[model samples]
Target chain A: MQPYNYPSKYLENAVEEFAKLPGIGRRTALRLVLHLLNKPKEEVEQFSATLNEMVQNIHFCSICHNISDNDICSICSSTSRDKTTICVVETIKDVMSIENTMQYKGLYHVLGGVINPMEGVGPADLNIESLVNRLKSNDINEVIMALSATTEGDTTNFYIYKKIKDYNIVVTTLARGVAFGNELEYTDEITLGRALLNRVKFNNSFSVE
Target chain B: MQPYNYPSKYLENAVEEFAKLPGIGRRTALRLVLHLLNKPKEEVEQFSATLNEMVQNIHFCSICHNISDNDICSICSSTSRDKTTICVVETIKDVMSIENTMQYKGLYHVLGGVINPMEGVGPADLNIESLVNRLKSNDINEVIMALSATTEGDTTNFYIYKKIKDYNIVVTTLARGVAFGNELEYTDEITLGRALLNRVKFNNSFSVE
Candidate 1:
């Protein structure tokens, strides 16, 4: 390689690392690298420190599995929220979507991922066991399954519905206002609100108990 | 204020800092912040260490004024490059532009910036004096002015041209193919290649000795 007069190995490595992020291409990565190089040394240092610190500080809360730095997430620990009603979601992004509406006064439980058999993500692969355990231990009255409208999402909802039906807790799914195969993450407030408004109770088919 | 579950003030501060980067809005910044959270503890430490190492390792070359991990840059130290010719540029990005073509095999001198009266950039503001001193001390045959075609760029070129003309050195500009008022960073290869090939010798009133 022709010798680069200005060689910044750290910048080169950091750019390579940044290019691995979703939606960040090579040219954009290079532009970012150049921009970082131009920044005051203190600012660049702070940027890197911030990235590392954020990663080290935040983690999945044990109670709700939502991203948090504490043992229990903010939503899970809050007394203001309806603790008896749990809004279950596939990811933290879905939680944010629901939270943005300022309508969800209920607590949350993140499933971590949807049950996709094709992707080898069965009920066992998700945090479904923990959710079931939480329902058994807590005084949860209603369990709302706010998963995506996809085939996998349906499969996960049914699986969850069968497990929790034995309990007196009312298991409800979001209304069919969401488009078929559309993820809950992409759904807007209006559609999500409609879905929430028209939720139906799911009957337990497997559990005769 | 909403209770942010992620309690580390330093971590939160860093995330806020990274959120200021171009194209990185708040949501994406949160994603990155979460991604860092998922990384192994050692890997997170390594990322921080890398940034600190970069700051400690990199330094500006005293001769060509290019960033390097050494006192003298690789281009300046290399015996293979054309030493008789020095390609003078506004920034390190300009140097990369010329290097990317793989056409120019000469040494370089980075002026840091061009003369912009509006930006308060004058002859003394740039690294012009060092460049002039280099010409006076060395047996330099040609000094190619690869500045932008902006009004400010032209002013800087005129100022540098006068000083270099006093020495018995051939001073040239990077041709008129570059569009008027355009920055060198955006010029395409074909246009830049044609410009380099069609470079005209400066024949101003103040002729070279």
Candidate 2:
């Protein structure tokens, strides 16, 4: 397809910048940039300034490698969280997902990325060393591997498990089973099999009696 | 759903700004903002700066009201373009679409937007006055209404038609029919009917033998 030539060089530049965003194509970029043009001057300024300030000021948590406004993240600083348990995740996004669940009260250690050999990412490339150091230094009891189900996530989890195996802490992976509201028939074979093997006794008290 | 509380305030701000975009949801915005965090500092600077510079420097063409880096757009300044004809479009996107076809040699008059009463947009909101002024001053013979097929587009077309009916200029709209590759069975009723009503004579000379 012939690239839609923007009437203005400025519009073209804006569209190009927008297209750099993940999942945004050139046409969608154009549409977005045009929408910005229709917005008030202050609104557009705020939009650009927000990004600029974020890029300039944002820093990774010194302890867990999660993004933070300060050197130490809010979760790391909070005394109420389960300091003994550290949920290891691939990125800050996973940390947010777990936090939103409101089920896990433990602290987090963001790996920044999983070990993907195809992408030239290895154990050394991640924040694994700091995690190992945290386990050695802190009075931690458990380390939960909350990575994705992909090969890269598995590889990263295995690498971390090997590194921290010598420590006195218990290392565990997130359970592989049929998710809540998911039908057993549609569940993947491995997940369904795991769910069946680890089946819990039906509790009458927990049911709507 | 509870908004994913980003660890960093800066990250939150960036995500908020991204979510302000036309079709972007909060989750997608977070993904994009997080992607920017992974990019190099200089690359992020370029992305923001590109938008900032574009917003600050962009202007509208004095004659046609199309977006321009300069006072006069490239099409308006070009000696080769047919000045006698002007294609009236609802937005700069339409102008780009037509220009990409490379079939029309006419200049364009971007309306910025069509009349939509429900959206509180009317003739006063558009660049209709300047278009009428152009018809009066310039030796333009024909005006092509390249607006969309929506009710708003039709409203805008009729409104403009009434405005320029007495100006001794030929006014026309884009052809309505089934698209070139579309099957007749799948074609919408109005388009198929219009195509039939405006049927052209078959010419063997123009066809492949």
Q: Pick the candidate with the highest TM-score.
A: 2
For residues B19-94, could you state the per-residue lDDT of candidate 2 as single tens digits?
Answer: 8888999999999988999999888888878888888898889998888999999999999999999999988888
TM-score of each model's chain B: 0.77, 0.95
lDDT per residue for candidate 1 within B179-198, as digits (tens), equals 76778899988778877887
Give fnat for candidates 1, 2 and onward, in order.
0.38, 0.87
Check candidate 1 and list the clashing pairs: A55-B36, A55-B37
Model number with the top DockQ:
2
User: What docking class should model 1 receive?
Assistant: acceptable
lDDT (Cα) of model 1 = 0.78
Give interface RMSD for all predictions: 3.9, 1.1
